[model samples]
Target: MASKKKRVKLKSLSQGRPPTLKPLHSLSSKATRTLISSHHTLQKLRAKAVAEGDEAKADAIAKEIEERGGIEKYQHASLLGQSSDRGGDSSRILMDWLVPIVPALKQHASDGRQMRMLEIGALSTTNACSNSRLFEMERIDLNSQAAGIKQQDFMTRPLPNDTKDKFDIISLSLVLNYVPDAIGRGEMLLRTLEFLKIPHHLDSGCQEIFPSLYLVLPAPCITNSRYLDESKLEMIMDSLGYIMVKKKLSNKLVYYLWRRVSFSTKRTCFKKVEIRSGKDRNNFSIVLK
Candidate 1:
């Protein structure tokens, strides 16, 4: 038999093409090694700082590392581009939504005065309270020990009846999620509005206390064990005579802007309230008279 023909296989390089690329795993292994080495270097630097008793320098280095990844990632994305005086982009976005409502609130306020605002769970200290020109901001929080922000216990005690007619705007930001139970959360909502004097006595004539409210919550709000669903929260607000005027959803949070449609209007002297409850509901009429 004739000698078997020699078999040949063309290599990629031999075909005048570059060799096929390796898988990402192969490529990334080297990169990962380098990153680990860099981390070790940073650790060494920190160790040196401590050994030399340069506590400030050590702290600075540690802070840099923290900023690179730690809790910084959880910081508000809109705050990424911001300065101290001007407030963060997140605050700006909130303000943009709030500006239109200002005039409406001002109209309802006594003597067309600037509206007072209350910000709950304002952990960052950069909420509407920072914007002096836009609102007279007051702050409240259940967590008195949280760093970097002021706190007040608006839940346990209602806002004084005398002051109920003072605030024109109220904000509940990322707070309802932390309330431990549904009954407590519902009570918190009622107490919060009560402090603002929402259900003004009809005999008193719309005293114009807290005409608007802005609530920023996680859209579904069910991811965290402490959080209540948005629907239930909305139902609670409806029961209190607040109407949702604007709703916005994003990857980060859901914002609802609410306004009082009308005060209690009833021929009877009884304080009967009618609030919008279902998804199809459009208007709420409260009879506080």
Candidate 2:
């Protein structure tokens, strides 16, 4: 008989000190992802507990969040993931998609006003969009990690009353997934419409230079979810007056550019419906109520 092979089991990320406890400079790719995911999950749990009026449960979750080094650590991990060695930055994708429309955007900006952008959940102020001359970017996050990023929650941000107040582009990269509940995610999607500039006309390019949404989400949320897929997402956006112009899918993420075509479409009722059945499928979903 062959000698029994001795197998070594790697220690789980949660087995010891929380990944966030490690120095930011020393955090590995796996550790960074773990920290960010754990933080987002804890936030969801805390939100649910509060909504259920369970103060004790909410307090306990808050304590755990503190012990896990708070939002600071999570932001650090996110920043680390944006470093050149890890994946450079998400803005690279946004820039790639915007390249074809640069000339049109430039013509629109010739009126002595730069194109405006509201980048929610922004981690860096030095990304591609920030460095571009054509865009005046307003970067915001729930927790500020740098001097330029304002500490503001997008949900509570005042709705724009004028086109000048609205943005030519609104980027919600890795933001919808941070919402704790399906209803919240739906609300977020609806809220974005209020912030985008009303398009006057379509410009010449592979994509329209009209007001648009640059949405980035984890691929698994749409690909492996029990309640969501590409079709469902397209349906949801269509009902919201958005038409997808460009989409890119990677192993880990999905990117979409949705132009606001019709501004007066009524909201459609979308409930949590199982679209896929698999033991391994995740429960990611968005409900438009």
Candidate 3:
């Protein structure tokens, strides 16, 4: 009789051995984007597998992630892209837009209190807005890389109770795309409102400055997604009472400044129905529940 085949068991994501991290340096722009995008895709697949209770598939994905050098390596690659030599700081463009449109940000506020900014998913303390004297910034990230950045999940942060706890502006650069699912992305967007200062009456330019969101996303999310486009994004923001103040689209990224126009309680249901169809379009979407 043939010997019985030995069974092979796989470890779950938590039980899997940690990946061997290698030092990442000088990652080209294309390579950095590829790594980030690949990680996102794998994460989405793993989320689906876990949700469907496919233990074996989840474990396989976990192994694949390990082989790819895990989250630490992915983050290191991202840091390379953000280096000054790459001109990868999204806030530089944000500063350019603000100086001409909202001159108040170029100088200290009249009350002697600098504008408060909450930078979610902050990777560096040396970025344009962080270095500027115009804003007192509180930077938070899921994985803090340095001393000043607090390691915190934005989703779990406590809601601001009073005006002092709120912020004048919130930056979510390249963050929404990192959310593993569509509904979570929408929730993150809604949560930004809870931490923002109340819409105060002021000059048009100044009003546009405070209680705003400086959003940066990969250009393909808007241009190549089957369920999202510029119009769709605008509609979603409008439902949340935010009006677009400025928008700039580049080859690889898209930037938007949205100011809260009103505290509208009206809700809009945006499902993940495909709004556009084309060959090679991505499935990126935001679902408002």
Per-residue lDDT of model 2, residues 1-289, tens digit only: 8444332221211111122333355688999889888887887777666666666767788889878887678778888888999876777888887887788777867966677899999998898889876788899987767899997878778888788899888999988887777877888898889999776655566237458899999899999999999999999999988999889898888999898888876789999999899899988899998
- The 10 consecutive residues of candidate 2 with the worst lDDT sum are 9-18
Evaluated at residue 223, the lDDT of candidate 3 is 96
Cα miss at 60, model 3 (Å)? 2.7
Q: Report RMSD (Å) for each prediction in the order shown.
A: 21.9, 9.9, 5.7
**Candidate 3 per-residue lDDT over residues 119-139, each given as its tens digit:** 998888998897766788899
lDDT (Cα, 0-100) at 278 in candidate 3: 89
lDDT of each: 0.47, 0.80, 0.79
Worst 10 residues of 1 by lDDT: 12-21
TM-scores for all predictions: 0.49, 0.88, 0.87
Output the better candidate (1/2) by lDDT.
2
